[model samples]
Target: AVFLTAFMPDCDGPRTRVIEEVPVSDWMDSVVDEEHAPPSVFLGPEFVRRKLYQLTSEEDYTLCQSLARVSSYYVADQQQRPPFSAARYGAVTKVYVIAKQDLAMVEEYQRQMIAGIPVAEVREMADADHMAMLSAPEELAGHLADIANNYT
Candidate 1:
């Protein structure tokens, strides 16, 4: 699947706030230092709602791990990388499905990304969070199915 839910790289919007704040200790726990080895960043349970999966159900939130580690170097690299060029995927249909209730990236930033990139189509998940697959599974799945049917 395409990168449907995550914040886009080139949107000069409020999502930049999240990127600017990510390397800080309060938001990320650097478990593996790149100075010694490959760098890794972990997000605690408390950070899930505010940063990753806002509006997630209590049960799923609890099921979520307090520490989920990912490569800090990779994340840092992504922040510096340029946005994907639409010309590279000549005939591919690019659809952006926005999660309106996502607090991590915010709705305004989502719209800004779409406007900046010029997607083939835009769809909204009114009540969905960043983790829409868990927060609003059926609706997300329906959208996915529709995309597959129409785009593919």
Candidate 2:
């Protein structure tokens, strides 16, 4: 058996448009306080170049392609909605480890999303933001270990 932890992708969605549209600096200011503002207001060209390079790297391209395909499918599925359906994947169990901060954005799907799925667990990492792995690695690792022990 394998245990997996959920994480938010580095992309903005309709529900996060307000924070996404704001200058990155403004958003950071509110979240981290002006006194500790980030070095740059927005993602500089250098950062973008590095990210593009990383995304296109041989080791990551496969994941990039898979994400692109999934994104396209999600959009198309949304446009032709009947009732919500789960994505078809071979995993024996799927646990959606949602961050407390991201709950607002995904709340709408809470009722319809897990209708027939066997969600082995739905753990919330309290006091953690979207990037919990980076912000709270120890806590995240503990949770993952616990999940692994229980599942395996």
Per-model TM-score, in order, reads 0.72, 0.39
Please list the Cα RMSD from the true structure of every candidate, rounded to 1 decimal place: 4.4, 12.9
Q: Please write out the lDDT profile of model 1 over residues 45-83, one tens digit for every residue.
A: 566767667678777776776445464545545555554
Please identify model 1 stretches exceeding 4 Å from their true place: 10-36, 70-72, 76-86, 89-91
What lDDT does each candidate get? 0.66, 0.40
TM-score, candidate 2, is 0.39
Q: Give a tens-digit lDDT track for model 2, residues 2-120.
A: 22223122112332322333344423212222233222123233332232222233444444344431111132323343432334342456565654543223322332334334666
Highest TM-score scorer: 1
Q: Please list the residue runs of candidate 2 whose C-alpha ends up more than 4 Å from where it truly belongs after superposition.
A: 1-91, 103-112
